[model samples]
Target chain A: MPDTGTNDMTEILQTPLHDLHVELGAKMTPFAGYDMPLQYEGIMAEHNHTRQSAGLFDVSHMGQAHYTGDEAALEKLITADLAALKPGEQKYTLLLNDEGGIRDDLMVSRPFGEDGLYIVVNAATKAADFAHMASNTAGVGELRIIEDRALIALQGPAAADVFGALLPAAAEMVFMQCGVFDLEGVELYVSRSGYTGEDGYEISIPAANAEAVARKILGDDRAKPIGLGARDSLRLEAGLCLYGHDMDENRTPVEATLMWAIAKPRRERLDFPGAARVMQMFADKPARKRIGFTMSGAPAREGAEIVKDGKTIGVVTSGGFGPTIGGPVGMAYVDLEYAVADTEFEILLRGKARPAKVTKMPFVEHRFYRG
Target chain B: MSVKFTKDHEWVKVDGDEATVGITAYAADQLGDVVFVELPDVGKSFEPGDEMAVVESVKAASEVYAPVSGEVVAVNDVLEGEPQKVNESADGDGWFVKLKLSDKSQLDGLMDEAAYKAHIS
Candidate 1:
């Protein structure tokens, strides 16, 4: 089963678009302390709809912050080389604890003509993540959590066309580029980036105007409001990691197969948090490595055990039906020996051992638009 | 033949000692897009409340329970290839199994069509 990452202790929060989701007949579920839409029509239909056109996602539960400080203060905590980040460019990076374990995965961008770096972190880790950044960056710079904004992602093939019709200049931005634009007098910080491996833009809008902008976008024939259900499947098919599942505080970037996200300069400098241990892991190779696999029969879900010859070697972290591939696809952290493509294994589901094999990810190929 | 429903959302159609079983439309609608179904083997005996089958949607897997004690006599092989049948016609062609009832008195404990509808509503 897909983990909703629901935190029950906190009072459930609602996004600005919560009413719109309810009006659209969404089945709401508690997720990361917020009541969010799980699906609209159905997961299969919405999953297929997004692969064909555009799907709007309310990612407002995610934490967004602005940092104006010495770049070194922030760079020390993450794996990215902030000094090398150019205006209008974004980098996927990881925040690490002292031991080199990933605290959370996030996006850091330099909005075009903006004074400070713009960062986005996962919802479940936001509170602690913000506190960590605030405490660490004390006096060197300021970390301002942007509570007045709401983030929305318009993803899939037709996203550009649907969103571009509103702001012509946005269509010109390539993948990983960020810019500030005006939409009917509302300022939007938009980045050509998304969790789905589709060509898309993540728009940060003022909370008060979010519903109006979302309604206007959904007015187009190519766009529909997608929920967390399809969002999980889409990202799984694209081989994107979901924080708190695929990787958490226990796994380092090296073990999660996210070494590419660590910039070359940062690697050479070895200045980022846990750099020594992470680099050492890079050299010695981690005992366990993340891998992707496809299998027939029932989908193996998170916490499912993976075995090789009756010996447990790994555990599934993310899994479900890949509507695009028409079969089961999942990710697991397995013994380094079993992480190779074509390495056969068995996944234990309900006490039955179903045959599986490690396969290269993007179980469906990524279609990011790079200009 | 008389139709009975279980609180777990399965429906049983009794004809003498044999009964046909499937999830109710309300259950199927709540599941949304059934993608896989694991039926029990024919001849397997099950007690009431036993997990007789597993129905998987794109999002989750749910166990279908035996409302009355029985031995599986025949399984719906079509669901193996087209599980969406559960969503399309959950009460008809999507029927899960044919059970040889072990206790006819168990049928009396289940709800009738009207009672089942009222229970769901």
Candidate 2:
């Protein structure tokens, strides 16, 4: 289970759309130091709604910042080749600790004609992430945290149709492309990328105008307000990793099955933080590899032990029902020998070993718009 | 027949020494979209507060505790295929098990419909 940390109600923070969420009858829960909506109508309903239509998600709790000055300064800290990241393009990258462990996974984008990079990090680790970036790049670049902005994602197959109606220019951009757009006088940084495995956009608007813009998009009949519950399910089906749950400070990118995020040029240079260790893992292959699996019976949630022939091989990191697939799906890190697809294993749930089998990821095919 | 409720959200409907058990509508609503259920075996005995079954939602798993000491007379096998019955007809066709009461006195301590409603409210 994802750690829904126990937060003192008095100190919990609220996003800009807190009132709007409550107005929509969202069940509020504390997540990442913010009092966020856990669900609206319900998880299943919201999950299906997003798959069939467009869903709006308030992700303002995520950290957004502007990295100005030297691109090399920023590249040194992450795995992505920032120099190759053209204007109006975005890349999913990871911030690695000196030991090659993933500190956080983030999106680094360069808005059209912009001088600096627009970065968004996970909410839970934003403070530490910012501090790391600031302290590391002090002499070369400036890491300006964007606290006055609110981020929201409009996702799903119908997202393009609903969003295109508002801004025709933005709708034309393909996946991973981003640009600044004017939405009825509101200056918004819109990225044609999202966590859900659908063609969508992540829009960053000034905190003050967030509600107005969100309400405008939600005004469309095809779009519904989604909460964290469905957001989690959508990403899980997409085979996307949740920052804290899937990869953490102790897990390296190779072990987490995210080596593709490391740009080839960076790999050739072995210049990013812990590049030597990461490359060595690439050559030797990590002892444990993350794999996706499908299982029957109760969902094998995080902390469930993965067993093969009565011996503990690994453990589940993320697991839940994949609404799209109509069954239980999850990810786990198991001994490399037991990570092959179709390999049968047992997931110990409540002391009972339940049958499970390794399966290919993105249990649902990704429908990214690449045009 | 007298229907009694547990604070844990289980409902027990007694017909003589035998009783039918299921979750209340309130409990079903709280556990959105029942995807799977693991039923206790028939003939198995459980004391009050013991885990009788496991109900899984799309998001998490919740344990259904035994409301009173009883021996499971029959398990709801239909739930294995159509667990959503718990969400659709939580008090009717969604019954999880029929139990032969091991201790009838345990039902007296449970809340009646009126008190259950008050407790939830």
Candidate 3:
């Protein structure tokens, strides 16, 4: 049964934009300890609007923190090459468990002017991630959670233009570049990176100025407030993983097919957490690998079994109808042999097995503004 | 003449020996953006509580159950081409399947519009 997440409503947290969401007639749902907007106008409308123009999203519920000690020592916990990152550069990386499985996927940034590394993690795993960092990397660096900040992602083709209107400096930054901009007398740390495969910016602003800044952006007719529902579809269409759904603590980097994020330099040293076990995965390949699949018929949801020749070969981790694809799309883990692209299989949705094919990802082409 | 509702959120409108079945607007509001609808074949018969159809939204899929047992006479072919019609006109043109009522008394057992409204609230 899917978790409604509505059980303990009293204790759920609220972002600074909570009242703003309610004022805009957003459908609110409890997610990852916060009552977040599920939709604004509607998922379909917001999703299409983002693809065509720009969509402003309140992702303040996600965890934002900073590490303030030895940078190389802190690098021992993440899979990415943090040491080589120039100031103002961001790296997408994974937090690995001792067993080589992914605890959470996150972004590490060497923010301009900041003496330490800036990190953003999944909302659901933030508590655990922080705890792990505090205990394991104790003498190396101090992890300080930035609870007073609010994170907003302005994504899609028009994102740069929107930010350009507010802060011209941010608009000039290339993808993965971070800079702190003064917006309406408040400091906003803007990064040219996002989960959606779009030319966008993720701005970390103070909680006080979030509503005012969000209002200023939405005041522009080119952008609208998008909710979590459309955000999920956009990310899924971009072939990005939703930490708990697409991957979890049980999935290793090799199994998740995220070798691209493991920088080449890090491969030589292999000094990160679970490097020994992760090396074992490199020596002897993972039996199963995650693949993007085209789902027809009834859309295969998470937990649906993937079957081939009357045998269950894999399971879908994240599956849903892709509005852009005009069909169902999913990410699943299957036996390495069956992981080949174009390989056909049947996904058992409910009690019925429906035809599906292993396909390449980015159901939609990533339009990240690469410089 | 009048519409009846099931606890599962499907509605049926009976006239003569045939009944038009579709999900209620409340259900559609709950589901949010119906991307696809899977209706049973025309000649198929279903029993009350049987899962006869499937409705998929962007994020989740739901099974539309039969509120009353009957043989399907027709289905909304428009839905096959444009499923969003269910979201556009959920109760009107969005009607799922027309069924030949197997048991007329089943309608009396279901909730009336007033009762459904009160049930939802």
Docking band of candidate 2: high
lDDT of 3 by residue, A194-246 (tens): 97788999999899989999999999999999999999899988999999877
C-alpha lDDT of all candidate models, in order: 0.94, 0.93, 0.89
For each candidate, what's the DockQ?
0.83, 0.87, 0.79
DockQ top scorer = 2
What tens-digit string does per-residue lDDT give for candidate 3 at B1-121?
9899998889999999999999999888889899989999999999999998899998688889999989999999999888888888889999899999999998999999999998889
Q: After superposition, how far is residue B106 of candidate 2 from its true place, in Å?
A: 1.3
List, residue by residue over A296-363, the lDDT tens digit for candidate 1: 98999999999998899999999999999999999999999999999999999999999999989989
Q: Using lDDT as the measure, name the better of candidate 1 and candidate 3.
A: 1
For candidate 2, lDDT tens digit of each residue in B14-80? 9999999999999999898999999998889999999999999987999999999999999889999
lDDT, candidate 1, residue B91?
91
- Model 3 iRMSD vs. native: 1.1
The per-candidate TM-score of the B chain, in the order shown, comes to: 0.98, 0.98, 0.98
